[model samples]
Target: MTTCNYAAPPFDHPQADVILRSADRVEFRVFKLFLSLASPFFETLFGLPQAPDGATDQETKDGLAVIVMSEDSKTLDSFFRFCYPSTLADDPSLENLTDGLSLLAAARKYSLDLIEKKVCQALANPKVLEMEPIRYFAIARNARLAHETITAARYTLRQPLIPAQFSEIELITASELLVLLTYHKNCSIAVQPLTKNLKWLTDHYGGCDACIWLFGPYYKGSCGCGQVADNRFSPWGIHPVTWWATYMQEISELLMDRPSGDTVRTAADRTIQQVRSMGCSVCSSTVKENMTEFSNLLALKVDEAVSMIQLEMDF
Candidate 1:
């Protein structure tokens, strides 16, 4: 119920022939040509024959035709600002997502696809995804932005504790909420295997001195981290009991750390951080490669899971 007492400055085009009046009666002078060229709806509307009834028609100071709009003054101002030659907002990066939603509504009303896309681009910036995924996700879903929807979904997985109800719940259907909750559960389950096994690292870990020294004592094989000629031999040695135990604890903590990225990427990042801090160059390189490969597989699993679910919004 907040009303603006201050009038917004009109985005005046000196040669404009059309006046747009907002619901609050603020007037903006703009070029009919600009509107016509930007939107086919406007073009067709302006092309129609008009009555010469001056009593029913509202005229501006310079005798331009006035079109009253249902949108509020602020929305009309923002909408026209985007249509004009000037920049759309004082700081688009700092603008609220709700403001962008308003602009989208106005642009849609006029069938300004280009302006609608621009508003979507502005709203999908990195700052918005990081700062407000819930709101962004709600808008993105409704807008039919598939990539943005997925990005926002991934960002939500970064939270250790997600809410069942939030500010924009009215905009999100029960099915979408279920998809998000399932996505989180799937991501957590996706990386759970990392805690039990890490022998895959030895496949790519060359016989570096540090690797041999570190892994020799714990190798499931007795060849001192050497090439076992047997075809059945796994080049990668299994994680020792103690290392696996620590890894179990570490991976568990990282999953609860509200780690960002998909399950695979999150696991890979956390594992690399843990491996590098151990001060073992061999361990770091080995685990890095192994975790990356594992993450790829996990990514595939997520895709497979996603294919079975419906998260798309028709409109």
Candidate 2:
């Protein structure tokens, strides 16, 4: 039998009843009562009768039964910290998705529901979710976490369709990837209407004397500002300037690549410049404020559209 070796602080308490030996050989001296309270798996484990063949003898260390855990020291340490009441003040930090998933796996394995809940909350942290949403989606989907999978998949829409490669990519299957891709495609389809249809804006431009020509041929309201001769169909079928067409086209293409409100919000720099530079004098002066308002509206609508799209999770 291998001799017991090391014990880290907090896990090295002298009054503890059991020694949980991590696969990496670090021993944690903890109370069986805490383990029993935290995990049904451990509770049933401790309630079992010892083997008559003296098999338990080889696992003993310093008069305490040594429970060898499959998890390594790092995972064991984090897992135990959640189980122990004393460590509740400083909860484990799941700074990254990988570490969060690892701790979650151990918590789930031991049937620690409360610990699993905590790990899930950490996984949903905005920093953690936005770090590498594709990787998070793959890992969460593989683990069959429905909420995490959907949340991560939605976050991925903020990124380009060709996701950055990561180690966790191997965790998901082709079918799962197809689901995400399909969801992305559906979101693009949903958002394209925002660019094509102008009815959603209603009559916001109704009273605007400077940009009335943008409604694409149905403008009887007023157009003191001369229409750019190129007069193309604007929202509400009024013929606006060519720049408006170009602006919407660019926004459409951008949303096709990344269908998210954040994309719409950050994507209008060049287009805004075009609108200002290409519009008539009156339109140019007010374009900045108007465009800002419009872009904000577009972002809100984009988010609303994307929210309606649900990622299908089979696992």
Candidate 3:
């Protein structure tokens, strides 16, 4: 074998100079210092690819070509700085409420804090509620703030005062009712007002139809009927006993008949069966553990404080 003295190209070669220059330009455009540092090695390893000879300015700016381009901090910052407010101001598509809602969703999804704030501000405007789905989505997503949103929506809905033929009450949904109930349970004097209202309503109207629907006829009949009365009918012509018996009988037969007993027993049995089927062992265990840990922590804190006070010699 003949020994050949072939030297690798120098850094100052014309090709190497072109590569370094291209890399520098790329780093400048991208405005990423890390990319700038690594550019020399990268350019040496891979030669700069040729751009299309006659590509238009718009084509390059639009970045629609097959070549892979990196979006560095500078480009992104510039793009957003101009594009965001411009899009908000001049975009005809965003004039549609649905588009605004979509933008809100996108802002939320991407964790774009400023964008989300802007979207929320837009939504706060009265004009935004013209989109029903957006209004519903906002209320549904932010359940904690739903009361405020509902109040705002009600105000908006009433403005220009166009009355519809059919009127629907903007009452809380069943889930929201449960949330309100749980919220109330933590407060003192909760049961007093509820009990008082229940009694007042019962005395005045002879029981609520909605309550009857929820708890069944047994609750309705048993609540107020005199001992000697075999049947109970409200002043509103609702036969509590008959309705309860019929509804219970229908349901019982459909899902395995239960023996005639106290409503509480029947309800308890149904609940137990449902809970058992749910396989909530983890939840039960976690709840038990949490309760134990909380009690222990409280006891430990109390003991620690007592010990500290005793050590202070003010006993």
Best by TM-score: 2
Give the higher-lDDT candidate: 2 or 3.
2
Higher-scoring candidate on TM-score, 1 or 3: 1
Model 3 Cα RMSD, 1 decimal: 23.3
Stretches > 4 Å off in candidate 3: 1-96, 130-140, 143-153, 156-174, 177-315
The residue ranges of model 2 lying beyond 4 angstroms of the native Cα positions read: 1-9, 50-56, 59-62, 86-89, 202-206, 209-247, 269-292
Task: Flag the better candidate by lDDT, 1 or 2.
Answer: 2
lDDT of 1 by residue, 1-315 (tens): 433233345456566687777788766777777678778888998898876676555554566787878888778776666666555334234267877878788888888877777777778887787777777888777666777787777777666547645566777788887777776666666544443343443433444333443333444343222222222222344333233234335545666434333544666677668667765545545667655664665455444443444444444
Task: Give me candidate 3's TM-score against the actual structure.
Answer: 0.24
Q: lDDT per residue, candidate 2, 1-315, as tens digits?
A: 665566666778888888999888888898888889989999999898876655545467678888888988888888887888864325677788767778988988999888887777677788877778898787678767788788898999989987877888888888889889999999999998887776566555554464443542334533244444432234444456555666677778889989998787666656567656665555566567766777788888998998998887665
lDDT of 3 by residue, 1-315 (tens): 322221122212222122212211331122122222323423333344545577633223223221122433223232223223353223122333444445544444434545544444454554544434224333433433443343333332212222222111233354543432232222212222321122333553355553343222244343332122222223233343332333233333321211111222334345335433544443222323332332233233322322222111110
Report how far residue 212 has shifted in candidate 2, in Å: 9.9
TM-score of 2: 0.75
**Candidates sorted on lDDT, descending:** 2, 1, 3
Reference-based lDDT, each prediction: 0.61, 0.76, 0.32
